[model samples]
Structures are given as C-alpha cells and as structure tokens.
Target: MMNLILHGYWRSSCSWRVRIVLNFKGLSAEYVPVHLVRGGGEQYYAEQRRINPMAQVPTLVVDGRSISQSVAIMEFLEETFPEPAMLPRDPYQRAKVRQLVEIVNSGIQPLQNLSVLKRLNSEGWDSDRVQSWAADWIRKGLLAYQDEMDSVGAQYSAGDSITLADAALVPQLVNARRFNVEFEGLSRLVEVETRLMNHPAFASTRPELQPDMEK
Candidate 1:
C-alpha cells in the first residue's frame, strides 16, 4: 500500500508538476482530488484546511507529514528518493535547474495562481484584471527565458535531456496558453514548450488527461 496521499486539483500546474515527479521516480501514491472551484473549493474545507493551512491544492501528505508548495515537494522527493534523478549531478548545473524552477514557481506561478485571482475578484476585479495579471507575468517570464536560453539552452533547459526545470516550465506554459498570454515574439521558449509537450512524461500527466477535469 502506498503511504503517500497527494491532494491536488486537476488543472493545477503545480499538481501536474508533482505528478510527473512521482511518475519519473517510479513512486506509487494515492491521488485525492480537491475541487478548486466547487463550493469555493475543498481546499478551504475544515478537514482539508487542516491538512494545509494555506488552503491550496497539490499538498502532499507523505509519511504521516503534510507537505505544501510544489517546489519543496519536488526537492523533497529528489532528496528522499535520489534515483532516476530529475536534476543534474553537477552543482552548477543543478543550480541552473533550480534557477529555472524558481523562476517559474516563485516568479511566474504565484502571480497567476488561483488564490490570487479569487482575492482579486473578492476585491471587485473583473476578467480583464485577471488577464492583465497573467499577461504581465507570462510575457516578462518568456522574455527572461528567451534571454537566458539565448546561450545555455540546448535541446532542453540545461542540456539535451529532461530535467526538473523542464518539469516546472511545461505546466506553467499550459497556464499561459490557457490565460491567452501572447508569445509570438518569444520563439525560443515557445519552441522549448513544444518540445516538452511532446515528451511523454509531461504530455500524459496534463490536466486534460485527468479523470476529474471539468468541462
């Protein structure tokens, strides 16, 4: 029996990230879906909120411990499992991968996360406000990616093979597209996204393929 319980939303990019890492690491775990929109989300429910005070989906309950934040979950898994490595072994190379993940997780994802959107709406903001928030991050993030990728980007973020960095990037790009963030000028990152999308690991774990995705 798997001892891990992953509380996640079907369309959440962070949830997708953790799912890919679990798959890549050959770990078996139970998936518990948290509806992020229904009844104002099960994440906010008393029982679920006790699991994570942040009231966010993608909270991993592992070894009788509650873990939140996707990046932390990924790093914890890497340290705990440490085989079929998602990050490079070299210190500098791993730093590069970490940098990429941070850009997406902290710099990009937070600005466009659902909680923030809900807060915005509660404050009387409209769809345009939400779109603007998403656009600002995705556009600037793509530009940053383009500049960085100009020299170091090979077939992937750090090299010719898949890494945790790629794991982080692909999901957020899905959000960017879902939010209609324009990427016509940032061709390199777009190309990278396309490449990652074709990779079976990412392609198969997407929200669209999930059992609980709403219509």
Candidate 2:
C-alpha cells in the first residue's frame, strides 16, 4: 500500500481542492495541518519549505515523495488512480476541462490567496480596500468562467459528469463567498456550485469539516 500524507490548512482553497479530489477518488491520506497565519505562517518554516519549496499548502507526499501545488497534486492523483476519472476522454473535452480548471486555478484563486492578501496588508491596504480588491478580481475571473460555460454542459462546470473543472470551481466559490463577491450575473456558476456541493466528495471534504478547521 502506498502511504500518502497531505500537508495543508483547513481553509486553504488549494488544499480544499486536493481534499475534494482525494475523496472523489476514494483515497485516504494522513492529514497534516499547516497553519497559514499562526506564528507568521508556519509554511515559511524550514521543515515545510523543504517539503514544498513554494511553502504552499496541499502538498501531497506519496510514499515519501512530495508534490506541491493543488493542480499538480490533483493531476498526479488522477493519473495514478485512473479509475473514477475526473477528466473527459475525448481530446477536445479534455482540453475544455483543463481550460475551465485554469480559469479558476490560474485566473481566479491567486489574487485572493492568503499570501497575496498579507502582502497587500503590508503595502498599507486597509481591510476594506483589500477585500474590494480581491472581490473585483474574483468577479472578473468568474465572469470569464461564466462566458466559457456557454460551451460546457448544463449540469456541472464541464458536463454532466464531475470533472477537474468542478473540483477547481467549488473551492474558488467558497473564497468568493468569503470576500462577499457578488454573483448577480453568474447564475450558471451558482447553479453548478449548488449541484457540486451536494456531491459527497465536495460536501464531505469541505473546509468546515476538516479536522484542522478553526471555530
């Protein structure tokens, strides 16, 4: 049996993405909490930096080999497990799935992540200003995501089946709600999120249910 260990924080959207993938694949990994805020961010410590050079959460250590970044970890798991696939088989469909995934992974999540927010704070941005900044970026990316959904199927981000796009979208929605980002024109995303959240993999692995979740 391959021993899998996941080092992450409860509320980190990237970490939450990996959690959803793990649950969807029915894989179990020992969870290790890395508090992103406590004591000036534990991820900066030498131990975690060694494990993940980027010092990011959702670092998947598989049989002693560590892989950082949520998308990378998700792909690794999908390629290794193969069963209960999270990506489509057709070339075009697979590319579409990756496009949607990147819409969230690359376009949306980074601007509002903890480190970026912390940097804004250091640069003298007040709480309200920082929140507004984050919300604006989220809105922009979500609008683009909504536009792309015209090509996707109705039920989920990509299609009727849950794909990597759904895994990426759900966690970003969580962050959107956190920043109070308006969803007026993004009804499709909201509807898709409603359906996705009902799935056991998404519902069970929510940040609130994680063992390291804070009250």
Predicted candidate 2 versus true structure: per-residue lDDT over 97-202, tens digit per residue: 8898898998988899888998999999999999999999999999998888734557988778899888999989989999999989988898999999999999
lDDT of 1: 0.84
TM-score of each: 0.92, 0.97
Error of 2 at 164 (Å): 0.7
Off by over 4 Å in 2: 150-153
RMSD of each: 1.8, 1.1
- Clashing residue pairs for model 1: none
lDDT of 1 by residue, 1-215 (tens): 43888999889999999988988788867889999889967889998888888898788998788899888999998998988888899898899888888888888888888888878888998989878888888778867766655255578776887788888888888888888898788777777878887877777788988878888
Find the candidate with the highest TM-score and give its number: 2
